[model samples]
Target chain A: MTDADLSRFSINQETVKQWSLPELVEGCGKAGVARVGLWRAPVQEYGVERAARLVREAGLTVTSLCRGGFLTASEPGARAAALDDNRAAIDEAAALATPTLVLVSGGLPAGDRDLRGARERVADALAELAPYARERGVRLAIEPLHPMFASDRCVVSTLGQALDLAERFPVEEVGVVVDTYHVWWDDTAAARIARAGAAGPGGGRIAAFQLADWVTPLPAGVLLGRGQLGDGSVDLRRFRELVDAAGYDGPVEVEIFNEGLWARDGAEVLAEVVERYAAHAL
Target chain B: MTDADLSRFSINQETVKQWSLPELVEGCGKAGVARVGLWRAPVQEYGVERAARLVREAGLTVTSLCRGGFLTASEPGARAAALDDNRAAIDEAAALATPTLVLVSGGLPAGDRDLRGARERVADALAELAPYARERGVRLAIEPLHPMFASDRCVVSTLGQALDLAERFPVEEVGVVVDTYHVWWDDTAAARIARAGAAGPGGGRIAAFQLADWVTPLPAGVLLGRGQLGDGSVDLRRFRELVDAAGYDGPVEVEIFNEGLWARDGAEVLAEVVERYAAHAL
Candidate 1:
């Protein structure tokens, strides 16, 4: 396939986690993949400026930064620390020249059963950081993880809920991430995708569109079990069509976290992803 | 606590799976828990009639039968077999004198991506079984398993979706199950619980209410990670209050499937469940 065929394609760093920052840039450059989604840890490890320069010089675009939210911490000191860390993440995303900072809103605090309250804390955190992110020319993308992670990873478990929170702020400053693996199960996702795509006062609420398949017999912890494209039940093309209909023209980032994918050669995995995106997600 | 305190409490058989029919009946009798929810497999293995007689002799009530759905088969032979098996389950539920039969609507057929099609098949199966269930004096309670199981265990992954399916039939013929473990993470659960509790054309649509806590680091397979009451993030007492407010005075069944709980002495587990229920779920 020509590069034009994969124009919107972006490789999320976690999908080929075995590759270092330099290897990732080199790999994507060789594969004709123009975009990459970087995780904060690896970027921080490589020195954000150095990693940014590496991708920039290699003619690769940073589509989005991995994450910046864990705002469910309610204790005074912990809340401050979370917000501070998120600010740092936004700075890193800005330095990397990425437009989006993906946020997995944290889950309930220890022994806390107040899901609504935890979610409110997320909204509060967003209010505190939205301005900082806006000033940095970075948009914060709220990602509603699958409901299974509601208790431990993110209380935002549906696209509708993410929209609810995102609508409270300017669409340019705050938006939602539609990760197929997380929302493909919900019947309301299509409508919500449309809503996020629809132009609001600021712009489209849709910031980042991610792709990962949902395979069965989820591995332990359920965190690293994301299936490779075409390996699970999600209809990736339908999601792409829905997002396209909703007016989103951003990078389509493949972000699988399967152990099996990680053990393979990074370039080989990237090649297969390119082929699979053409086969299953075009 | 007095027997009056646990008057609404029901021990789901799977909670103490190590116990046989006789042990379960005796344990419930001694523990002052007057009702028990049962699984079809163990009941059939123990002989439905004999098991029914044993519970009757022990003066214990059978609150509900474990399951009767998986109605997502597409092939004609498999669909017919699924209907026949559900009819058999209805017969067993009737024999056991339980008014409710929990249904876990099956996931998508293997290699299929049409989730809406799979869901429609569940509706068709319900239509086929509803009349039979009504005639047998059993209500098919559609249990929306957690979204994590959307691809393998159940496609109805939200209370709202379950109600949409259940509302299609006469409330007496079909209803929705509000299992806290599966729905606690949902922001709309409280409102949906009210809808399920509201008096519709055929009375309240809530056929059964089950309880299990949401624990972390979900085990491999993610099926048996249900935590003991009060050991996880669910607001159990709030769920009870919501169900109660919705005018559902039916049994509040505690169903857990943790390996730790299963490995413990059945009596000790039962006793601990009673105490935890009193402390957290009452």
Candidate 2:
């Protein structure tokens, strides 16, 4: 890795899902970002093999896959299918040469009042996939979403919660994706980051660092409107400093999902993301 | 307290601010609610003495005063005014015989980056007001708003955070107000409630237990839109059970601030609140 590699950043494709894979690659290349994180739906839409080749051919690194872990369903058969899908996602991440596969722990099983039990199912699902991912040289990055999404999205809602789950597997095979949008509001964010950096109860692992700004008065269905870097209240420089302090020198990927950004030209969005990463992040 | 007391829930005035004080009182009385939480602005607007008399004449308990604490400003003049206003609010709470004066710890001071500094300022401000409140026989309940409001509204964002602040003052003078809307998503909510109940850290010191539903797709300016019980995702019964387990047998106040509820007749809103509290919150 060169000096360029040290400052490497990626534009998560969700930031411009409206664009095609080739267009995203061209835009990221023009923006001087050496990497990009892709979502599975778009990969499937473009054909996984072709998508992987396009990323490689564009001379861009596929930093990580956007997701793969909704393994908490009411039926065992559905859960099994999700695991199978995740196994396939892991293979895709490996083929794309990305080192980590982001895992979004799914929500409550129907008719189940036990949130903790649902969380346990996520762990069981991860454990089943850990060996296969490790064999393929891909790490699982459990991304704990905002607590607001605890019901219908992710039961794991804190970095500490994700770290606790990650403790069940080997550090190299299982770590966490620290997304600022989801965890910035947490009182124990710094402590949890430090813990994730340390030799975990599971293993010393800090696999990925994802970034997005925190905006106030979060609009409903908050899965969208992720503010562009430096556009919202979160202090990205401080976040970068915290991540550096945590002893993790991983890629700082910009993973925003804003309607405003999406509506713009993909190249323009990528260019703005790169400039913000340079100006606002260390 | 009669078995009737068990059915007596309070509607925070903000829940039906569109209603006049006398109208709210009449509505609460009609709904069989034992109490109502009043705000300083509304009390002042309605005439404090007249509001108190109306509440009394209507046979309603002033469960608490809605607020009095933005003591984390950078200017001494503003801080002094906050203190003076809090003192006046205490007098009003005393006039209504309301037991608790709710305190919302203000956000970071202008030009100040230290969250800990702002928190300390809140503690100092509380210390200054504790004696006056004790003399008035009014308890100050520090209400920790959710962390999304940490920068602009309140720095105190967790029950544990509020409890830590409460420990700085005497148990009789200062305590925490646990609102389900603010703390329902906390990972350690049950443990924190149990800890608050353990009295002085080890056992029962929760000063107030307030109820509201946690609705999803939270709208902008999230200070509003608190769901009525059972209308949203929160498990009010679990909360009640936790508080009961923590040894708090206080009145379970029903506080909803939904636009839908607000547009309805105050009496109908109050009636629905009581019905929901009984059916869903126990």
Candidate 3:
């Protein structure tokens, strides 16, 4: 495939979760994929500086970081630890030279029936972290997971809500991740995307645009059931066009979490993703 | 439980799906539960007229009918048949003396990415059915399934979206169902609940109030994973309070769909549900 074909395509680390950091860098280099989204655990495992050097030497840009937010913990000790870890994550993103650190705001605390209160805590946590992230040249991207994850994974469940939270800070410090699997069901998402992209001090909150299809019969726990690009009901092309119209000329990172895909060969999955991006996303 | 304690309680049929119509009637009678929500399939299996007579003789009021929607079909023939089926469902609700006929609007037609078109088709189907339903003294209740079911089961995924659709028709003709399981995750649900219960022609669209809990490690398919009241993270009492504050004093129906609950003896399950309702939802 031509480099131009994959100019905007980025393989999120979780999408090819079987690959080691070295293997990921080597594979992307060989496959002519110039961009990747890395996760914190593996980066830390391989030593963040070394891993960052490996990607740089391989001529692959770190498009974004997998995550840095579980900011819904209510306990003082746990909350403090969470913020410290997030600060570390922000540092890791800067070290990796990625512009964005995606955040999946944690869901309700155990026995906590106050969803509003949990969400408010997320806002409070962001208020603390945004300035820290900005100082390190990393944008904190608030991702609104599907509502099914609202109780256990992330309380932020819509683009509008993400923007509402992100708009509380400067666009440079905070932003939103528009993942098709998470926000595709909202009829108002297109309008919200336009709002996020509108020009102003508060606009351009589209920090990272990620792609994953919403397939059903979501596996038990519903965590790793994201479908491959063309295998599910999401209109990937429409989302791409929407982001394009909204002036987000950024990497379209593929971030499926399917066990089936993970079981396949990493290079094979990467190649298939490139082909899928061309056929479905463009 | 005393008569006053169980005053607003309604046992939805699916919660004790293993029970026969006769068993349900006898069981509710023995438990002093005055209200029951009926499902079309079981009512039809027992003969609609006979089931209606049985519940009536048992001194039970039918709070609402289980469902009467799949109204997003695109094929002309399928669309006509779906409308016909919904009409029969409305007639059955009327026969059973239930004012509300729940409509789970169908998702996109196969391989169709147009969610807006599919939802528009639901509005079209409702336009045709609302008058027929009003003539029979039935309010067509648009029930928004959680977004996880947006691809295959229902496109209506929020109270706001349901209200948007329901507002097009007269309040007596169209309304929305407030089920805690489906809507507990939405940050805007409480505000929308207040809107649904406001006074006037545009308001008071809450035709049904159902309760179920949100549990984690959702089972495959995610359909039968609804938790028993007090068994999961939902703020059942708060939802009840919200509805109460919004001027809705309707039947509080318990509608769980867990495999474990279904495996138990129907009477035992009903008694447990009653106990949990008292503890969690009152």
Q: Of models 1 and 2, which has the larger lDDT?
A: 1
lDDT (10s digit) by residue, model 1, range A1-282: 344488899999999999998899888888899999999999999999999899999989999998999999999999999999999999999999999999999988998999999999999999999999999999999999999999999999999999999999988889999999999999999999988978553229989999999998888999999999999999999999999888888899999998999999999999999988999989
Candidate 1, which segments miss by more than 4 Å at Cα? A1-4, A201-203, B1-4, B200-203
Q: After superposition, how far is residue A48 of candidate 3 from its true place, in Å?
A: 0.7
Poorly placed runs, candidate 3 (over 4 Å): A2-4, A199-203, B1-4, B199-203
Computed on alpha carbons, the lDDT of every model, listed in order, comes to 0.92, 0.81, 0.91
**What DockQ, on C-alphas, does every prediction get?**
0.90, 0.43, 0.86
**lDDT ranking of the models:** 1, 3, 2
Off by over 4 Å in 2: A1-6, A109-113, A200-203, B1-8, B109-114, B200-204
Best by lDDT: 1
**What TM-score do all the candidates reach, one by one?**
0.98, 0.92, 0.97
Q: Which ten-residue region of model 3 chain B has the weakest summed lDDT?
A: B198-207
Q: Which residue pairs in candidate 1 have backbone atoms (N, alpha carbon, C) closer than 3 angstroms, thus clashing?
A: none
Query: Which residue pairs collide, candidate 2?
Result: B197-B203, B197-B204, B198-B203, B198-B204, B199-B203, B199-B204
Proportion of true contacts reproduced by candidate 2: 0.27
What TM-score, to 2 decimals, does candidate 3 have?
A: 0.97
For model 3, state the Cα shift of residue B207 in Å. 0.5
Model 3, span B92-195: residue lDDT tens: 99999999999999988888888988989999999999999999999999999999999999999999999999999988889999999999988889999999
